[model samples]
Target: METFTEASWYEKKENSIVKCTLCPHNCIIKPGKTGICLVRRNIEGILYAENYAVLSALHFDPVEKKPLYHFYPGQGVLSIGTFGCNLKCSFCQNSDISQNGIRDPERKALTDPQEIINEALDIKGNIGIAYTYNEPVIWFEYVRDVAKVAEKAGLKNVMVSNGFINETPGREMIEFTDAFNIDLKGFTEDFYKKHTSSSLEPVKETIKTIHKAGKHLEITNLVIPTLNDDPVVFEKMVEWIALETGENTVLHLSRYYPHFKVSLPPTEVKKLSGFYKIAKKYLKYVYLGNVADPAMGNNTLCPVCNSEVIVRNGYKTWTSGLDQQGKCKNCGLKIIEHI
Candidate 1:
C-alpha cells in the first residue's frame, strides 16, 4: 500500500474526481475508480499510479526477443514489466499483466532500480535493461526514474512499447533510452480506435520523434489473422516507415495467436512470409517472428552486398558478419544499429 505514488500526467477535478491525461484516452476517473489501464486510481481527488515498482513479471531475455534486431544483436537484457496497459488490444500477448491491475498478491515482487541495475551488471554479457511484457508507458514515473538510473549506471535502456506516449514524456524517454521496438499497431486510425482504444497519429508522431533523437529504433506489427493483415494497409505502413523514419528501420512482422478476448486462430505462416517479403521493399532489415517453420526471415542480409550478415535460429545469433565498427564486413556499408 505504501508503494503507491501520485501519478504524473493527470489533473485533480471537481468533487474529488481526477482526470488522467497520460495517454490520448484522457480518462475521467471517479474517486476509488481506476482508469482503463487499471493501474491508476483516483482516490479523494488524487491520481495514484498503483503499479509503480510493483512488478508483475521479470526475466533476462535476448535483445532480439524485444524484437530489436538492429541494436546489440546477441546480447542479453534484463526484461521487466509492471501491470496495466493504456491500449486495450484484443490480441495482447502479455494480456495477463497488461489487462489487469497487478499480478496476484502472491506473485507480486518489489524491485528497485538499484537492484535491477546490480543484477544487470552482474551478468557477464548483459547489455542493459529492457522494459517489456506490458505497455511500459502507463508506468511512466517508474520507467522514467529507472531509465535515468540505468543511464547513469552505464546500462543501455530499451523500451518494447506500443508507441502511445505523448510528446513531453516521450521526449524525456529518448534522453536515456538507447533502443526501442515500437509497435505501430495498425496503419489506420480506425483500427487503433476500435481495436486498441488508442489513436494512430500520436504513435506515428512518437516514431518520428524517436528517430529524430538518433536512438536505435525498430518496429513490430502483430499480424492478426484478419484484423490488420490486409496487404494494402501493411504495404502502406512499410512505406511510411521508410519515408518518415528512414528506410533503415528494422521491422519485425510477428504472427498473431489467439489470446485474451480475441479467439481468432494463429496467423498462417505463409502470410507471415509474404509480408516479410513486402516489407523488404521499403526497409533495409525485416524479420518474421512468433513461429519457426522454414526459417527464412530470421537471418539478416546485408542491404548492399546481399550477404548474410547475422544468422539467427531461435535467439542463437551469429554476429561475425559485422565488423568492430558496426558495418558489413564484406561491403563496408555503415548501418545504423550499435552492433
Candidate 2:
C-alpha cells in the first residue's frame, strides 16, 4: 500500500511539482522522488510524508539514555522513533534506522497515542513519550497529536534530535514538549556541510527557539577526533553556547568512537578534558559521556556553591544537595530551574 502525505509546509514549484520547505535543505523533489529525509516525497504535484503513522521503533528507555540530565532525573521515558533523517551524519550511531529507506522486522507493532500513553503509565518511574531514534521534526504532526494526548494525561513529551528543523515547525512542536536534547554536531558551517550535509544556522535557531519557549534544553557535542576536536574550534563552540543560550544550560561533551563511514578514530580523554576546562569558563553545567574519565566530568556540581549537587554514579542520580524545589541546599542557590 502506498502512503499519502499531507504537507502544509511547502511551496508549489510548478504545475505538477512542489518544494518542501520543511528543513533548511529546501529539497525541490520531483514526482516520485523522495527528499533527503527519504520520508517526504513529491507525488504528482503533491508532496507527502511517507513515515507519517509508519512507526519503526518504540521502547521504554532511561531518560539518561536520552542524555537528558536535569529534567526528571533517573526516570524512564517511553522512547519512540520513525525513520529517515534531515542530516547525513557520517558518524551517525543510529544510521541503520535513520539513514535506511527499508524497514526492519525486529521492531514492535504500531500503536496509537492511547497505547503509547498506556505504556508510559505501565512503566516504573516513567515520565512520557520521546520522539527519538530518528528525526522527530519530520514527524511533527504525529508528535504534536501524541504530545497533546500525552500532555492531557499529565505525561511529559521529550525530543532527542539533531536540531536541523526550520523555525515554524520547531516552534509549533516545542509548545507541547517539556524538554529537548539537541545534537550541536559542530561549530562551523563547513563541518555541517562536509559531515552532515546540512547547515548549522537553522540548528542554532532551533536551539534558541527551545530556550526562548521556556522549555528545558540540553546540548550534545559529539567530539570527533581531529575532524572537529580542534581546541580553538571547541572553545568557540563553548563561547557561543554560553553567550547565546546562557551559563545554566547543560552541555554533554560526548566521546566519539569510529562509527558509520567516518572512521576518524576515537576521541582522546585528554582532549575531552581540555575541552571541558575551556567550556567551564563560559558554561556552568558540563558533563562528559561515552568515555571513562576520573568521574570528574560524570557528576553534576552546584555552580554557585562549588559543592557536589547531584552525585551521578553512572546513571544512578543521587539528589542529595538538591532541595524539594531544586535549589542548592548548601548556599540555597537556584541551580536548575526545573529540577
Candidate 3:
C-alpha cells in the first residue's frame, strides 16, 4: 500500500507554498517542508498526506478502554492509530508515536482502509473501529476513508481525538464518525497555551459542534496536579459541559502521571475524589480513570432511581441493571440507548 495520498482542505499560495487548513494551526509549507503535524507535506506546491494509511499500532480492545463508559459498554472495538499530532503537549502519554512520524518503517505497516474494516468485522465481539492512540484528526483522509467502509458494513466508528480540527474538517468528522471521546485538556486558556501549545476555545467549539449534531459525545480531562486541578476552574469546566452538552454527557476524569516532558508527580487520589464530587454536582455520568480503586467511580447508576445500571470492574462490564431496551430494570428510566 502507498503511504502518500493527496490531502484535502488545503489551498495553494504564491511562491510554491501551501497552506494547510485542516486544523487551526493553518501551517504554511514551503516546498519540501511538512506542517506542524509533520505528516502532511507540500511537495512542489501539492499537499499530500504523507502518513496516509500508515499504521503504528492496531489492537482489539474493550470499548471501555476507549474510556467510553456509555457507548457500547461490554462490546469490544478494533483500535488503530497512526503517528503525528497537531498539538505539542508537554506531558503527552503517547509521545513515542504522537511526537514522531513514521519511524521504523519495518515495524509500521501501510494497510488499506477496507482491510482495517475487514479485520474489524472478523473480531468476535467487536462492534466497530476506534481511531485512537495518536490524534486521529491528523489522519483525517485515512479516517474518512476507513469510516466510509465501516459504516456500510454495519459497524460503528469511534474517534478518540484531541478535538483540534478546523470547523470544516470537524463537520466532516461528524458526518463519518459515529461516536467521539474528545479530550478537553483543561478549562483555562493559560493551561492550554502553556501545556498543549493550542487554544481552549476551539476545543470547546468542537465539543459543542459534536453535541449539537446529536452524536454520542464523551469528554476526557487529564487532571494534572498543579496545573488544572483547581476546584474553581474544574467546577467551571463541568458547569460548561452540563450547560452545553447536557448532564447525560459522559465525563472521564483521568489521573495524570509524569510522562514525556513534564516531571510532575501523579495526581492525588483525594484530589480526584474532590473533583469527582464537584463534577457530580453538574454531570450525571462521571468516571474516574487510571486509579487503583475500582468501586469508587467505575459503576453507572440510574440517574432517576439511584440504582446500579452498569457495573464495571476494570474493563469487564456487566449491564445487569438495564433491560433489553437499555432502560433501568428497577424503574424503567432510560439510561443507555445503544447497548
Listed in order, each prediction's TM-score against the native is: 0.96, 0.94, 0.98
Ranking by TM-score: 3, 1, 2
- Alpha carbon lDDT of each predicted model: 0.86, 0.84, 0.92
What would the TM-score be for candidate 1 when compared with the true structure?
Answer: 0.96
- lDDT of candidate 2 over 112-167, digit per residue (tens): 67777887788887788999988888777678878999999989999998888778
TM-score of 3: 0.98
- Top candidate by lDDT: 3
- Sort by lDDT, top down from the best: 3, 1, 2
Better lDDT candidate (1, 2)? 1
> Model 2, clash count?
0
* Each candidate: RMSD: 1.5, 1.9, 1.3
**Model 1 residue 56 lDDT?**
75
Best candidate (score: TM-score): 3
* Candidate 3 global CA lDDT score: 0.92
User: Which segments of candidate 3 are over 4 A away from where they belong?
Assistant: 1-3, 105-110
What digit string (tens of lDDT, one per residue) describes model 3 on residues 227-294?
88889999999999999999999999999999999999999999999999999999999999999988
Encode model 1's per-residue lDDT on 1-339: one tens digit a residue: 555789988988789988888877789999999998899998888898888878777788998889888888888999898888998887788888888777653444544678778877888888888989988989888888888888888889999999887788778877778999999888999999889988999999999999999888989899998899999999999999999998888898888888988999999999988998899889988888888553578888888899888889898898888898888899998763586
Residue pairs of candidate 1 with colliding backbone atoms:
none
